[model samples]
Target: MSVFPIRFLTLAVIAFHSNSFAASGQEQQLFLLIRQLDTLDTLVQSTPRFEAPESNARYRFDYPRLTQDIQHIRQGVKDYLSPSRAQPRDPNELVGDYRLDAAHAEPWP
Candidate 1:
C-alpha cells in the first residue's frame, strides 16, 4: 500500500524497456553487417575469372583487397560482440588463509 514500492516498480519497468530497446538495436545492426558480408561473398563468387593481362592484375588486386576488407569487417564484428573484461584485483588482498603450521590445521586420521 506504500508509494515507494509503486515508484520502484515504475523505475524497474522503464529500465527493462530501455535495455530491451538498446539490445534490439544492437542486434539489428549486427544483422545488417552480416547481410552485407553475405552480399560481398556472393559478388566475389559470381565474378568471372580472366586469363588476360589486365584482367589478371585486377583480379589479383581484387582478391587481396577483398581479403583485407573481410579481415577488417571480422575484427570490427569481434570488437562489437566481445564482452568487456573483468576489472583487475588488488595485489594486496589475501585470497585465502595460508596456514604454515601442520599441527594447527586439521589432521587426517
Candidate 2:
C-alpha cells in the first residue's frame, strides 16, 4: 500500500486538533463524543450480508459495548446541553454552549 493515505490522515488529524477548530474544552470534548457516537451509530446500522448462506451461519456481536455506547452518547448530549457543570439547565435551550460554526463540527462516519 502507498504511504500517502496514512500520512494524509495523520496531517488531517493534526490540523483539526488545533484550538481554532474548537471553542473551549467542553466544546472539544462534545465534538469528540458526538463524532464517536455518530461513527458507532453508523457502524451499528450497517450489517454484513452474504449472497449465499452457510449450513451454520453465526456471527458475534458486542451487545454490551453497543448498549454502553448508546448510554454514553445520551449522557454526553445531556452534558453538552447543560449550561452549568453541576446540573442541567433549561430543556428548551438544549444547545447552550454548542458552537453553530461548521469549523467546530466534527465529521460523522
Candidate 3:
C-alpha cells in the first residue's frame, strides 16, 4: 500500500472526471441547437402560405430574423466547441525581432 500508487490513481481519476465534464457541456450545447432547429422547422410548417402582398411582405420580414437567430446559434456552438482567441497570434510563434543583413548577401551562398 505505497503512497505513490495512491497519488497516481487520484490524479488519473481527476483527469478523467475533468474530461467527462467538458464533454457533457459540449453535448448539452449540441442538444440545444438541435432543439432550436426543430422548433424552427415546426414554425415554418405551421405558418400560412401567403399570396397577398401584405402577407408576403410580413413573411419576408420574418425571414431575416429567423436567419439571424440560426446564425447566432451556430456561432455560439462554434465558440463553445472551439473558443475564440483573445489575441490573433500564437504565443509559441512569437520570436524576438532579428533582421537579416542583406548588404553582404550572396545568391544561394
Candidate 4:
C-alpha cells in the first residue's frame, strides 16, 4: 500500500486538534467577558440617583432605561454561556436609543 493514505490521515488529525484548541481559547475569552459584564452591572447599580436640570432640549439621557438595557445584555450573555436548551432567541431588541424627549419645558430660545 502507498504511504499517501497514512500521511493524509496524520494531517487530518493535526488539523482537527488545532481547530479544537482554537475553539477552547475562544470560549475562555467569552467567559472573561461574562465576568466583566458583572462588574459593569455593579457599577451601574452603584451610580448615585440624581435628576438632571430641566431644560428645553429635544432629548435627555435616560439612565434608568440604559441600566435596564445593560442588565438585559448581561442576562443574554449569561444565557449564551450556559444555555439550558436550544430555546428560541428573544424576539425583543435592545432599545439602544437612550434619549427620551425632554418633558414639555420652555421652548428653545
Candidate 5:
C-alpha cells in the first residue's frame, strides 16, 4: 500500500473530528441558554402576587401566561436540538404579550 493513501485518510479523519467539535461548541451555547430559560421560569413562578387597591390601571403583568410562554420556548429549543424526525410545525405562535387588562370585580355588599 502507498503511503499517500494513508496520509490522505488520516487528514480526512482529523478534519471530520474538528468539524464535529465546532458543532458541539454551538450546541453547548444553546444548552446554556436553555438553562437560563429554566432559571427565568423559576423566578417567574416565585414572583410575589399582589392586587392593586381599587386602581384604574388598564394593563397588568400576566405572570402565569408569561411562565407558560417561557416553557414553550424552552421546549421548542429542546426539540430543535434533538428532533426525532421531520415533524409538522406548530401553527400556534407565541403570545408574547405579558401585559393584560386587569380584571375588575364588584365590591361585596
Candidate 6:
C-alpha cells in the first residue's frame, strides 16, 4: 500500500542482513584468536625455560622478560575480548537533576 511500509520493510531486511554479517565476522575473529591462543599455550607448555620449580625444576629462574611478554599479551587479549561499556542508554532517563527551578523538564530525549 503506502511507500512508508515498503521503505520500512527494506530497512528491516538491510538491518537483518547487516547484523548477520557482523555476527559471523565476530565469530570468525573469535575463533581465530582462540586458535592463536591455543598455539601459544602449546608453546608455553613445551618450553623448559618457562617451567616451575615444584613441577619440579630444582631452581626456577625469575624470567622477568618472559613474564612481561606474557602480561602484555594477556592484557591485549583481555582488551580485545572485553565488551565495550559505552552503550546507548534510554534517552528518557535524566542524568542530572540540577535544574530544579523549572516547572518540569521533559524526559531527557
Across 8-48, the per-residue lDDT of candidate 1 in tens digits comes to 33343344335444677865655555555556545544445
Name the regions of candidate 2 deviating beyond 4 angstroms.
Answer: 1-23, 49-59, 64-68, 80-85, 88-109
Q: Name the lDDT value of residue 80 in candidate 6.
A: 55
Using TM-score as the measure, the top candidate is 5
Q: lDDT by residue for model 6 over 64-90, one digit each (tens)?
A: 333344445444445556646644333
How would you encode candidate 3's per-residue C-alpha lDDT over 1-109 as one tens digit per residue? 1233224333433443354445677566465554655565445444444322332232222332333444554455555556676534323321222222334222220
Residue 78 accuracy (lDDT) in model 6: 51
How does candidate 1 score on lDDT? 0.42
For model 5, how does the per-residue alpha-carbon lDDT over 32-84 read when each residue is reduced to its tens digit?
65776766666655555554534667766666676676677677768878999
Candidate 6 has a TM-score of 0.31
Candidate 2 collision pairs: none
Q: What is the Å distance of residue 57 in model 2 from its true position?
A: 9.0
Error of 3 at 51 (Å): 4.2
Best candidate per lDDT, number? Answer: 5
Task: Output the worst ten-in-a-row residue range by lDDT, candidate 4.
Answer: 1-10
Off by over 4 Å in 4: 1-21, 54-58, 104-109
Regions more than 4 Å wrong, model 5: 1-22, 51-56, 104-109
lDDT of each: 0.42, 0.44, 0.41, 0.55, 0.59, 0.40
Query: After TM-score superposition, what is the CA distance of residue 74 in candidate 2 from its true location, in Å?
Result: 3.5
- TM-scores, all models, native as reference: 0.39, 0.36, 0.33, 0.60, 0.65, 0.31
Q: Each prediction's Cα RMSD?
A: 26.4, 14.5, 24.7, 17.8, 18.3, 24.8
Looking at model 5, residue 27 earns an lDDT score of: 72
RMSD of 2: 14.5
